[model samples]
Each structure stands twice: as C-alpha cells, then as structure tokens.
Target: MPANESTNSPLDTLWRVHAILWMVVAGEGLAVVLALATETSSDRLTYFGRLSVAIQWVMLLTLVAIYALRKPLSRIRPQGVAYVALCLLLINTWVTAGIAWLLMRDVGPMPAGGWQALVLRLTGIVLAVGLLGLAAFQNHWRARQAAVQAKQAQLESLHSRIRPHFLFNTLNTGVALVRRRPEEVERLLLDLADLFRAALAGPRQISLEDELALARRYLEIEALRFGDRLSVRWELPGVMPAVTVPALSIQPLVENAIRHGVEQLPAGGEVEIAVSTTPGTVVVRITNPLPHPGSHSHPGHRVGLNASQVRIEALTDGRGSVQTQVAGGRYIATVRLPVGT
Candidate 1:
C-alpha cells in the first residue's frame, strides 16, 4: 500500500515498538502472578523466568509478523480491523504456547494435562489483552476522526464565505469595465471562469503551480480594476517546489494586499510575491506598501485574514502558519508551509 493510504486505520496506529513493548510488559507481569499461584514449584524465579521468556518471544515474533502484514492490514475496512486483530491474536497465542511447550519439555518432564491447561490460560490472557488494546485504539481513532471532520467543516465554511465575496468582487469589476473595455471583458471573463473552476475542484488542496495560477488570475482582475495603480513584482525561484497548499490560500493574502495597501496609497504601490524553499519547508511572502494614515480600510479584511490563517493552520495540522505585520513601511504577510503539505 502507498504510505499515504496506510494512515487510514486505527490498527496501523497500534503497530509501534513502544506499544508492543508495553503490551509485552503488561502481559508478562500478569502471567507471572498466574503461574506462581497455579504451580507448586518452590523455585518462583524459575517459574517467573519461564513465563517471562515465553511472553517476550511470543510478543517479539508477533510484532514482526504484524509489521510484515501491516501493508495488507491497513487496507482493511474499519469494521474488519477488530476481527483481523483477534485472528492475529489467536495465531500468536498458539505459536507462543507451542514454543513454550517445547522449551518446557526439554527442561524437565511435563505432564500432558498441565501443558494443555497452560496453553488454554495463555490463550485467554492474550486474547483479553488484544481486546483491551483494540478498544483503546478504536476509541482514539474515533476521536481523531471527529476532530478532523470538525476542522474540515470549519475550513469549508470559511472557504465558502471567501468564494462568494471574491466572485461578486470580480463580477463587479467585469461589469464596471464592460463598456469602456469591451475587448478586455472576454479575457476578464475567462480568468473569472478559471478561478471558479479551480475553486470548485474536487480536493481542498491544490499544487503550488495551480495555486499561483489562481492568484495571478485574481491579481489580473485587480490590475484591470486599479489600472496603473496596482503593480505586481514576483520573485519566484528558478523552479517552483512541488508542494501542495490549501486552495484559495495565497490569493486571499494577495487580495488583502491590493485592497488594504496598494489601493490606499496615493500613487499606488507594488505587491511583491516571493517564493523560496528550505530543507523541509516552503515559504511564501507577500509584501505591499503600508497603508497611509487616515486611508479608507475595510474591517472585513481583518476577519478574512484571520479566517484564512485558521484554515491553513488546520489543513497542515499546525505545521503551516501565517503571520502578518506592518514594518519598515510594508504590510507583509508570510506563510510557512511544510513541503509534504
């Protein structure tokens, strides 16, 4: 299975070294108490050692088998995960009992009835451990899924608000210039169509190239609206990193720059968009001339900025962030994203 597809189940989450170690330790501790109570042997250390070694071997072997089967297991549906887990537990118990039986027989004469009883008890104990572990894991998985669903819903809500606001603004721009620049209207409409098409795309994420194209279209409309007042300066790297970003993320920051900074200035100003990469992160910076004092400002821009910031943070699970500030006569919005995002 693909690495990305492996994270879909709770079973996969439980198959870690630390978790396996915990299970082995807990199971062995319980087994020691049971063995000491049931056996008449005066040498408690020998009895404890036997159970410890058996439990350790069984757990280690089972862990290895689980690791080998993880790819196939991860593809199983949520409902089937428990059944598969129980089946694995049964197999692990039988293998462990066989090994323990062999070692016990070599050590000394072992009664057949005693061995049979020991195997049954071991199977029951291991099955109980498996069931408890599965329950805990399933609960954790449900909670995680709930959180993701909530975040997704919030993002979609915020995204919906942004889409209509942008559409109307673009439509109004087109309407305003329809008669004066009849020829430009065709190109304007095409850009508008492309923007909406991208907005309505299947996934909530899009490649950096697609995102940049969408932002450029928005800027194109703003350029038409502001005429010579809006200038764009791009400092893109030689090659754009193949990274995915939350859709509609960059364009909103660009819109904020045009709305609050460039248009507010008397002679207009430049919106500089720069993209660069570090070892594991991709950074996007948008800077525009700071708004002059007493300049008209829309309060909605602040709300929109906050919303976009929240959406990006949610999509990247807080690995990505947005920061904005006015310093050195520039209103700067910077986004830091992990390359894997």
Candidate 2:
C-alpha cells in the first residue's frame, strides 16, 4: 500500500485523542507516587493536579475545535485530517502548559516572567504530543491493512456463491421442454447463455439497459418453460440509458419472483418489475401473485429467497435492505439501495 493511504482514515485520530488523555493521567499518577516516596514536598501535589487539568482542558478544547470545524481543515486541504490532529496537538500542548505556568509563576525553572515559563511548558507538550501521534498513525495503518485482507476473504466467498444455482434447474427445465416440444429450445438456450454471462461479469455496476436485456432473456426462458402459465409486465423507463444499478441486483429478485411466486402458483399469476429513483436512493420493487400458503410450490425449497437476501446485503455494505410481505394476496419484495457509495 502507498504511504498516503495510511495518512487518510479517521479511526487513528480517535485513538490518538484517547491515548494522549490516558498517558497524561498516568504521568500525573506517577509524579504523585514519586513525590510521596522521595519526600519532595506535600505542596507539590497542588502543582501536579493543576498541570494535569490544564493539559486535559487543552486536549478537550482541541477536540471541540475538531468537532466544530467538522470539515477536517477550515478550507485548503479537506483531506488533511492527520495534519489537523498534529496542529491541535502542538497548539493545545503549548497553550495549556503556558496557562498552567501562569498559575504557578513563582515556581519551577522559569521564575523570571510568564513568557519564559511558557517556553519551558512547551517542551513537555511537544514531546508528549509528538510521541502520541506516532503511535496513533501506526494503528491507523494496521486497521486499514486488516480491512484489505478481510475484503479479499469476502470476495472469495462471493466467488464461490457466483455459480448460478438456478441455471442447473433452468437447463433441466429446458431439456424437458425440448423432449416434449423441441421447436423453442434453441431460442431458450440463447437466452440462457446471455443470463449466465450477466452473472459471471465483474463490473460493480451495470446500465439498466443491460439489466433489462438480461432480465428479458431470463423472463423468456421462464416463459418457454412455464408456457402460458407466466404473465410478465415491465414498468421500465422510457429513456432506458438514463438508469444504472448494482450488477445483477434486479434479476435475482426476478428469479425469486419466478421461483417462489410464478412457479409456486400452478394456475399462473402476474409478475411486475419496476425501478425508480429518489434524491439519494434507487428503488426496485418485484411483486407477484400469492398462492394459498400450503398450496404454493417452492422452487428448490426457499434457497432462492434466502440467497438473494444474503447476496444483496453483502454487496451494499449494509446500506441496502430487502423486505418481503404478502398484501391483498400479492407477495411483494422491495429492495432499497443508497444512490451512490
């Protein structure tokens, strides 16, 4: 990985704030213990307590500045989260120490003036904050490294699941149809090939034009197998090229409509496919006629429904969801995904 990638994630900034606070607290505790052991002066406890609180206030003020700005830097470098933290460290440490020294102006190395005391205070602040930044950046790098590793594992899992489960069943259906009525088999097989190509392709997103083409092919194959038993309708856009969607997202729902919806109802039913978009999201709804609970046939049990849910969830980074319910004797599964990642 490039060094700059490590310079970007926010998790490191979180840890740096936390670690600095803990070290300052621990250092105060150690100073108190030493004073007691060495018989340095009971009055010194007051100085340690005041310095610790002042340093902590500086850290807290820096955090408040971070939250208030919220844009990483006020302007110029929007991506400079690390640089902001470093600036906060230097300023907070220097300012907090300067204030603490003012309160105890008569004590320590600089008995001359407040400005002289301010310089001495900066020394500890600089050392402590500098060291803390180093530790935090290491953690940021490791966490991102781990994220890359986990993503590889997930892609491999998707690779295994990518084999078309429905294809085996689909081809079998085509073979049976060919044995009984061979004329439509060639047309059906071509459609099947196109559908498989869509599944195997690796683009993260696809144009709706391609999705409609693929969905149409899959629908044609079902139409061949089911004959007059399947009724399909599309509420697609007039300008098809204006739309795009996550690859294969629409078809699996369509497959589920066939497996659990159309194929389940022997007397036949209507399957409706539609897509629309809102300000920051895309909506796809698949609705099909419902059968009496026990009277319905499940295509390969409930595997299709279960698998589609898992696959969509994985692809969306948890921003998308699928919900299934029966309303007015119609089974509806609507999927919602954020418009852009």
Which pairs clash in the backbone of model 2? none
Off by over 4 Å in 1: 1-7, 11-63, 93-119, 301-303, 310-314, 325-327
TM-score of each: 0.76, 0.62
Alpha-carbon error at 88 in model 2, in Å?
Answer: 8.2
CA lDDT of each candidate?
0.77, 0.65
Best by lDDT: 1
Residue 36 in candidate 2, Cα distance off native in Å? 22
lDDT of 2: 0.65
- Regions of model 2 farther than 4 Å from truth: 1-148, 240-246, 299-315
lDDT of 2 by residue, 1-341 (tens): 11122234453344465656675675566446544544333466765665457655766777777767665354434236556666776777677666756776576544344566546645654556556765776576678667656654654454345445666767777888798789877898788788777666653556656866777888888888888899898886565435445566567678778877778776878899887777876677899987667874644544545544554555554556778888988889887766553
Q: How big is the positional error of residue 120 in model 2, measured in Å on the Cα after superposition?
A: 6.6
